[model samples]
Every structure is written in C-alpha cells, then in structure tokens.
Target: MEGNDLQRDGVARVLLWGAVLLAVAAGMRYGLLENGLLPRDCLAPGSPVAPCAFKTALVQSFLHQRLGWVSLVLGGLAFATAGRRLAWAGWLSGLSGLILYSYEPAAVGAMLALLVLARPRGEQRH
Candidate 1:
C-alpha cells in the first residue's frame, strides 16, 4: 500500500497536539480522583462516597500513568520522525488510550490521538 506518505509536514504538528493531550492525561491521573460523570467509583472504595482504596484501582492508575509517559515519548518520536509511520504510532497510541481510563481520560484521549493519526489521510480533514 502507498499509505499516507505524501509529505511528512503534518506529523510533527499532530504529535505536538498529542503531546498536549498526554500531559493533560498525566495530570488527571496523578491529581484527580473525582469523576463528574459517574455517580460511583467503579474501582470501589472504603466508603461509597470516598475515594478508591482497591489495589485494582491503584494498579490501573499506575498503568494509566505509564500510558501517559508512553504517549509523551511517542509524541516526541512522532515529532522527530518523518512519514506515515508517525501516524501509525499515533494510531496505536490512541487505541491504547481506549483501553486505559484511569482518572476518566482515555476515551477522549483516544479520540484525539486518532485524529492526530488520521487527519492527514482525509479522515479528519476539513
């Protein structure tokens, strides 16, 4: 396949934006325990109204932290590298985001990352 490689100019811009999202996710994962949308902590806590205490939550949160770090690294790589390969990395990163939602971030981050990956290919172009 020819892939999306016509020129590599857009990847860096995309990566820069993805980097911003990653930083945001990182901040939320490390700082926030509240989810405005959900009425309950799905991870469970000592009290229903209290923050999470489950080892599962702790583990998931750590995984999310790692995802943030990976996103940051991938963003830098995308910015530094050329061609559609960067887009593939971004696409993969987004897919990963969908799987990790600690601090309620991954869903939106996944969408944004997909945009970064697909924009140059007319998937998001306006």
Candidate 2:
C-alpha cells in the first residue's frame, strides 16, 4: 500500500495533538490532587484527606505516572515518524493509558486516531 505525504502529515498531526492533550490532562490531574482542588477519594464521605488506603493509592499512583510517561513517548515517536507500524504501538500505548491510568476517553480517542492512521496493506494508488 502506498500513502501520500498529505495523508501522512495529517495523521501525524492528529497523533501529536492527541499525545499532547493526554500529557496535559495527566499533569492537570496531578496538579489538582496536589493542591487539594480535587478530592483524593471520591468515595469518601466529606472532604476527607487521602481517604484511599495506602496500598491501592500507591499502586494506582505508580501506574498512572508510568503509563503517562510511556504514552507520551510513544505518541511523540508516532508523531515524528508517522510510520504505518507505529500505529500498532500507538494502539498498545493507548490501551495502557486506559488500563493503567484510568484515562478512558483520551486513551480511546488515541486508539481511534491510530486506527485511522494505519495504512492498509496491498492498497494501490491507481
């Protein structure tokens, strides 16, 4: 399959913007938690500080931090190259964002974007 430069550039932009948005969202979430603008535990009764148990919170925090970084890196690479193979990597990274970080919407959006960006095999320009 042969893809044109315009198609590649458009897909790359989508992936790049999606990646940037995901990173920004993660950072904003962290900032909100740090400043107490958002409650740590939504399940807890009113305004309790750090209501979540130590172990669960720790694991979740670790996962989110790691997945967020991984997603950013993968997204950046996809944006830089826009290779057809990188679409697969982007899908996996987006899945990690969904599973590990609980960023369902952004992860899903990235997944869809990657899917659209992937060029089909055996396609002919003519």
Candidate 3:
C-alpha cells in the first residue's frame, strides 16, 4: 500500500511538471509572437490577417496570450494539492488550455494529473 501511494505520488509529480513545461513553451511562443519575432498570421492562410480567418486574430491573440499563465497556476495547484475539488479545477484549466491554444501536451498532462489525484487510494479498492 505504501509503495502504491508513493508510485501514485510520483506519477502526479510527473504530470504536474510536464504541464508546467508545456505551459512555459506556449508562453514562450506567445512572447515571441507579441514581440514580432514571429509572424502572428503564421496560422492564417494569407497575410494582412483577415478578421474572418480560421481562429481569427482576436480570438487567437486572447487565448494564446493568457491561457499559458492560467494553465501554469492551475497545474501547479493541482500538483500541490490532493483534494477532489482541486482535481476537477485542474481538469477545467487543462481543458481551457487545450481549447485556447490547442496545446495537447500541457492539457493532457494536467488532465492526467487530475485523474491521478482524484483516483481512490489502494486501501479503498477493497
């Protein structure tokens, strides 16, 4: 039972850290784009950034600019706590990150972290 708990905790740690790394990467990309180091319309088909383009500049800008920070905090909280409510919150945060930036790795890591945290202990299995 102790070993199982330890393993679960280890898994949780990995998930949390992975989420943080992904968040950081996403944030870095945002920073680059904002600074003009990278083209903002790279995701768009043509230049001049048409307002109706897929995932319009406005929406993409909002999501890309903010989701990373939100995910970072939520993922860190999920890592530090084991409460069920917090786990759910982490799931929500991850989903938002996924939607806003389509950052699968960060979102998936956060969701998995929540799952691990929310799982019943081995003692409860019986």
Tell me the TM-score of model 2: 0.36
Model 2 regions lying over 4 Å from their true place: 1-64, 102-117, 120-126
* Candidate closer to the true structure by lDDT (higher is better), 1 or 3: 3
lDDT of each: 0.48, 0.52, 0.53
Candidate 1 weakest lDDT stretch, 10 residues: 102-111
* TM-score against native, each model: 0.32, 0.36, 0.38
Q: Let me know the TM-score candidate 1 reaches against the reference structure.
A: 0.32
For candidate 2, list the clashing residue pairs, or say none.
none
- Candidate 1 regions exceeding 4 Å error are 1-64, 102-116, 119-126
| Candidate 2 structure quality by residue, lDDT tens digits, 85-108 | 465556555654654454644364
Task: Judge candidate 2 against the unseen true structure and give its global Cα lDDT, from 0 to 1.
Answer: 0.52
Residue clash pairs of candidate 1:
none
Task: Return the top candidate by lDDT.
Answer: 3
Model 3, stretches more than 4 Å misplaced? 2-62, 102-105, 121-126
Cα RMSD for candidate 2? 9.0
For residues 4-111, what per-residue lDDT tens digits would candidate 1 score against the true structure? 653563666655766775676545444453344223445444535423434345346447465544544554455444325654554445544543442234333344
